[model samples]
Target: MQKFGNATIEILKDETLSKNWYHLRNITYNYTNSKGETKTLKREAYDRGNGATILLYDPKIDSVILVRQFRVPTYVNGYHGWLLETPAGLLDGDNPADAIAREVMEETGYKLRDTRFLFKSFMSPGSVTEVLHFFAAIVDATDRVEEGGGAAHEDEDIEVVVIPLADAMKMIEDGDICDGKTIMLLQWAALNRASLTQ
Candidate 1:
């Protein structure tokens, strides 16, 4: 690949701010705009690697499975700590499909099969270096092998929630399901219900 346009980027300094679970880097760079104006900027980016998320929909019953758990960031932002969201997790070196399968089983107790790739998105492109791969899988009663409440060792306390697809949409309008990835997947499901049901 070749660099496009007349803009140029130069890194001035790179500093590691934190490296607990993931890594946080403070970077200073000089970006020359296409108009030949150069600006030096400093920004901190949190690199949690990339992750995958999946929406488990049972088209036969017009229902979807989601999970609720406490999110510290949300809690500190003035909202309730618990959020209803689709099953998702860090890739942890696994492929997106494999990671989603493992996370789904761990969070919702369902073995996912035939996961259809939907799309990829940068949930927070400004400060987080995370590209989330999205997928959807059809599942039914037979797939539930255990009562999943997230991984005990990981301190994940998740509550499984199953509701009609219509109701899930209502929750979105009612400000109940406010998670970005969950909302995006639900909208996709609504737009592709007929084909997805088949």
Candidate 2:
């Protein structure tokens, strides 16, 4: 391990607080060098954290569940307002499986069961330290109409979309699914959907 530039934020320029997804400090670090000289350097310092996501599924129908929401970031840049994604959230408390299960239920309103572990890796390893734990969760879709999204404090105004696993795979090719978590979950299912269908 190596230590580089270290700096503390004199003041947090912008602070956004939420019951769920929240940003704290603005501790801007030079991230240039440490007590020793280095040969290479990359990014400065920015927001970095770990998170969890789940591909909730309904074994009864052999269908997968995903959410389409108006991503402010994506909309601000370019593309459609809705981004097809798995029911996911940050592991704010560090409990991997529990965090993912909670997110799945809140975002999709389908109580998850038998959340099989899928993947654990970073989302944007380049600049963001967003690590996500992916899972294929079992959910009850019989009452999907009444059960959708978490509380308002969750900042999740999500619209649930349930489709066949095969169709989701098609969306990936047609550019409908662009998020990393969704892609990873689908890739996982493609290899093990047969054994995990129930």
Candidate 3:
């Protein structure tokens, strides 16, 4: 099978949408299909920042740690005001694991040690340039969860929630979780929970 010629995108100009969380960039791309003729596509991509989601597991407790928060977009759309989600954070300038580990501790007060990458995926294959690298983390559940352990400085108002694995799965099935990263990571953990522990 013949493949398209190498495609490249050049940043002509980038406009920041949100301070650090989101950005809209104007770019020019050159793609040559089966024909050698060069085609240019000038388009805008949303730079939502690369991010990560951590599915924290505790074998002894038979549960996972999640977080509850209010999302502005959901509120505006009249969706569930409060959302059940996993520990996720944007990879500002750090690696996915480092970002997620810090997020876990900051949001849930669980200092995780061994974090193994499950996989990485494009958040929206259509237009968004954002990606989500996911991981499964193991942490002991003995630590007390202080309320509102969010990164207040960064405007994160997070509430930690501990759920039995079964309950978490139920919520997912009931259409409670809308975050893509959270859903993928939790589904991954649910399918591989036994192997994940041992």
Candidate 4:
């Protein structure tokens, strides 16, 4: 990466820390400060590739679709394991829209016809090298074709949840919905409901 604004970055070393389903790399870089001082820093970044997430909303019913499942990371961090989140998964060589559509079908049992691209963000930029593309889709009753709880081989046991948009926003305040990406999408929906419905 080239110098940006007041800092210059140079990669000194990049070593793979782990390689299983995903990759973790330990990176050492030299940072040249504005004062021309160079400092070396090391950090480990988890690279699970890029991912996509989508929130499915039904304007006719004023509701949204979400999923609940056990998250080991959240469990180990002292909260209950189960998390309510929008359907999402890694791109895995597929385009963002295709990956999100597949994930939505697999996790929520809904085949999306048209999806609106919202934005992209880094969920955990400080330590993880993952960027997530966010999307929103309008859906109705006809979209559900099968019971989706994720693939059997993937070992994902997800529970589909459909709730009113108002209730979901309340859940965020009550700490029931805590996933970062989910929260962002919900807030976006709340703010742009009229336009989104149209």
In order, the Cα lDDT scores of the candidates are 0.93, 0.70, 0.77, 0.94
Of 1 and 2, the candidate ahead on TM-score is: 1
Q: What is the lDDT of residue 72 in candidate 3?
A: 82
> For every model shown, what is its TM-score relative to the native structure?
0.96, 0.76, 0.83, 0.97
Clashes of each: 0, 1, 0, 0
Model 4: runs farther than 4 Å from truth?
none
Model 3: per-residue Cα lDDT over 1-198, one tens digit each: 224345333444456545555677666656555545666667777877788888888888888888998888888898967888888888889988899877787888887778898889987867788788888977776654544468889887888888888877787788877777777877788889888787
Q: Which residue ranges in model 2 land beyond 4 Å of their true spot? A: 1-37, 40-42, 142-146
Q: What are the per-residue Cα lDDT tens digits for candidate 2 across 118-150?
A: 668866666455677777766665545447665
lDDT of 4: 0.94
Per TM-score, what order, best first? 4, 1, 3, 2
Which TM-score value belongs to model 2?
0.76
What lDDT is reached at residue 144 by model 3? Answer: 41
Query: Pairs clashing in candidate 1?
Result: none
| Model 1, residue 15: C-alpha shift (Å) | 0.7
